[model samples]
Target: MALVCFGIDKFPDHCNFVNGGDGSVSTQTVEKTSTNRKLAPRYRVLLHNDDYNPMEYVVQVLMSTVPGLTQPQAVSIMMEAHTNGLALVITCALEHAEFYCETLKNHGLTSTIEPDE
Candidate 1:
């Protein structure tokens, strides 16, 4: 009938339930339901090779469009696209991926976003 945590919240996860009639501790265990929240789905922003935009331009655009992209990282992404025909620029939330893809397109670069599998 009384909830006693013994003044500590982390000793035993379950609280002891007492029965007033028999003055005996009940064996029924109280379980806490853990919240397993699924994360928001992410999308991958991809850069495609194009003959129109120069390699330097693509690197610059990538650097400008995606924050925290260093020059070396941008160069690597550009090189990947140049050599393989396509490269993943970033894997992020849907909105962010869309914005990055559109920004790259606006800069005359070939860019697309696909759901990360």
Candidate 2:
């Protein structure tokens, strides 16, 4: 690319400059980003403590939905939900979080997903 200028009396007929044609100069920079791009909305799925759901059942649900959570970890989460009236079950894409919430509800447990904020 080139830029040119023209004047009637004060300047020359034209002034030209190469913008970016050779390898010596770069006109644009491309940035590489991480491949793990997140497209879905981020959500926090929470389990609400309730009288209808048994503690053991809560633990089971936690273990199943939360990836890498063990039996003891599930129990701990259950206790937190029981005592605190609410506990974060998982942080994930909105679709998965909603699925988890619905599964918990199907199991007769009170659950919901909200924005992480």
Specify the highest-lDDT model's number.
1
26-115 in candidate 2: lDDT tens per residue?
Answer: 223334456896677789988899987789888987777667989987888789988999988888988888898998888888898899
Weakest 10 consecutive residues of candidate 1 by summed lDDT:
4-13
Top model number, TM-score: 1
**What lDDT score belongs to each candidate, Candidate 1 first?**
0.88, 0.78
Ten consecutive residues with minimal summed lDDT in candidate 2? 23-32
Q: What is the TM-score of each candidate against the true structure?
A: 0.71, 0.63
Q: Looking at candidate 2, what is the lDDT of residue 30?
A: 31
| Native-to-model Cα distance after best TM-score fit, residue 111 in candidate 1, in Å | 0.7
* Runs in model 1 lying further than 4 Å from the true structure: 1-33
